[model samples]
Target: MTLPDPADQADNPVGGVRTTSTVSAPTARAAWSITFLVMILQTVNFADKAVLGIVARPLSEDLGLSNADIGLLGSVFYVLFVITGLAGGFIADRVRIVWVLLGMALLWSLVQIPVLLVGTFTALIISRVLLGAAEGPAGALNNVAVFGWFPKSKRGLPSAVVTSGTSLSKILVAPALTVIVAAYGWKAAFWTLMIVGLVWAAVWLVVGKDGPYSVNSARERAKAGSAGKVERVGFLRIAALPTFWGGVLGMFALYGMVAVILTWLPSYFEQGLGLSRVNSGLLFALPSVTGMASMLLVSFLTDRLVGRGMTVRISRGMVSVVALFVCGGMLAALPLVDSAWLAVFLVVAGYGVGVASYPLMNVTVAHVSPERQVASTLGVFTALFSTSGILAPWLTGRLVDAATTPAEGYTTAFQIFGVVAIIGAVVMALTVNPERDRARIAAIDPLACADSSADDKY
Candidate 1:
């Protein structure tokens, strides 16, 4: 259970796993338990990130902030999230992922707990910055941890399930956090997340192993010598890949929509639809719950389908397009709806679509990129896309400012999101590399229809 001391990634390529301790026995049950633990940590990870958004009003009022200022909170997290994401990937490529996750989980949990003390905007912002910093390592290491544990074909479902951490966190946080705020004031939300985070850290220690090597992965990697043989690349070479930029643009838009919705949903419901804070929180949690289900369904189908020979373009990209279409439909219908609750339902449905896109797009990015640089490339990808965190929230806030009512904001913001998703679908459609993507899937799973013998006919 020894951890890698933080070090330069270049000195030891496999993050110096040679220093890692003994391997444990592998079993279907242990893998499932490990997978569940990953999901729990992920839940804490996202719950902390999302609490500010879920309880936006009370916190903002206590700190004397405006919509524009609230939006910037996302910026702090995204900035750190992006920067850390870059470094995390590199570290993941070089480091012992389990230990990296173990350390990050502990730090990030402590960071989220401090929001209880901040009454001033400056203090709140500083608190957010600290939380963001902790999140950086958590986000990066989590990806590496996932990659280290699961095979490529099997990775999609487990990854998506783990990724459902965000959705599940929102599900719990939106409703429960809203209630906590109503009962105990804004500070309770932060304290609550802090408690949950610390608990998750303890759980990880008890259940989490160092890597696949500690249990089953060691035997599997030994069987496939190529597992540990990936080469590390310099930043400049990684920067030059078109696929890198493509990932950036795609992820940017993806995260942009996600960030905007996270930051704006409560405000939109309260101000636009005129729902009470408690009601809005409860309603908001609904989509996220639905999103969790959709995510698992999409990821499971993705792995099985791709394993059966579906193209990445068709599998990942097309599945993502489903979210865009639904989101668009929800937006387009917003203005026409008379019932406030109905409109809320529509928007929540759109969020469901947003949930579906998360893991599929990530897996797509991983598939196209070289494995050695997956973390670095992913880091840059998250950073650039998360850069949208800076822009989308501001623009959406402006849209909120201009709207005559919460309903109007809901209608307008959603329409804009719909158009954005449509454009994304078009771009994704043009980039369908089914054959190449098929090869990528095949590389991860021997049974995936990646054989040259079948290539010519397809």
Candidate 2:
């Protein structure tokens, strides 16, 4: 149950740089335990997101709100998302990540109380804004935490596993929350989530600690003169790379579709497709189930490819290109289909295939970034792409409002997402050269590319 000592490991190469090696079997089990915990953490984080969408219809009805108003409510959550994601990244880099995660979880629970107590539009806005801010860094931090337990070559699967937590939330918790909303009403769903967040926070507080591969652990090694320090580079240097921006752009498009799904997919199923609330909720979860399977498959293949000596351009970059392209094509075809079943298939296959790019893009960025700047780089990356959260939902709302029919509006929105995904795929194809970017980083700051083993000592 105890974490393995990094001092027991030998030198290892990670992402083209020498670093501390892998843990023993028992240590790896402990690491995997941490990974599983963070995966659950991600589950809770996404459950918070999916709840608003599950209750969107009922809440809008209760508030007597228009489509535009509902969309604005969804958009408001991300008003503070980008800013907090950036700030949280810097904070995580400086502070103990365990503490940062703890603080965020506690805040998530507190934010829900606003909606529970007031049940007003203004109160809902307040809750969404606060919750968005708290959860903004969750994605980046979750990746960083899980990465701390694994070496570069083995990171893809864990990253996918962590990101799949969102899929898990949609597939499992969303349906359950839908029932809760059905039985107890929208405010009751908020109350339930608040309790869930609190319970998770309590568990995390007891079990959470930095992994052996964490910056905190590295700093301890440096203090003991057992590890050589990797010089920290300015954020700008890391940001300037094409790999960074390309990955960001790809993720931006993908996450935009994700935002639309989380905020509007259930509504689409209910209103656009003419499904019952329960059925809509179930259908709402279908894409995520496919998405989860796709991500795991892609990650497993990607890790295997990397392990087999394939270049990242082929393993990570090309995989993203293919997935995004498939997603785009499926989405574009959605409006063209006549049957509801066909439309559902397009959605499931499109979104499911498209989301696999998320883990690959994350690993690509992490691979190219200076180890010391990974947190900040990831923070900035998350912040930039997350702007889509603000735009996608609001824009979809406006589009739907402008359309003559609900189905027309929803299909138009899906088409736009399709186009964006295609563009992202092209960009990723052109720019996601992890080996080249790694070399570029090393050339810019040689010390940053030095062996990480000095920092790897537990």
* C-alpha lDDT of all candidate models, in order: 0.64, 0.82
Instruction: Kindly give the number of clashing pairs for every candidate.
Output: 10, 2
Q: lDDT value for candidate 1?
A: 0.64
Q: Please provide, for model 1 over 259-285, each residue's C-alpha lDDT reduced to its tens digit, 9 standing for 90 to 100.
A: 777777877778777878878777667
Candidate 2 residue-wise lDDT, 1-458, digit = tens: 44334443223334443333444434767787888888888988988888878988898889998788788888888988889999888887778888888898899889998888888999988999999998889899888888877767778999999999989999988989888889989888788778888888899888888876675654554435435543567788788888899888988888888888998899888889888989998788899999999999999998988888888878888899999999998998888988887888899889999999888888888878765567778888999999998988888889989999988999999999999989998998988888887888777765564434443211
* TM-score, model 1 to reference: 0.82
Candidate with maximal lDDT:
2
Off by over 4 Å in 1: 1-25, 137-140, 213-230, 233-244, 432-458
**What TM-score, over all chains together, does every model reach?**
0.82, 0.93
Model 2, which residues run further than 4 Å from truth?
A: 1-26, 222-230, 453-458
Residue-level error in angstroms, candidate 2, position 241:
0.3
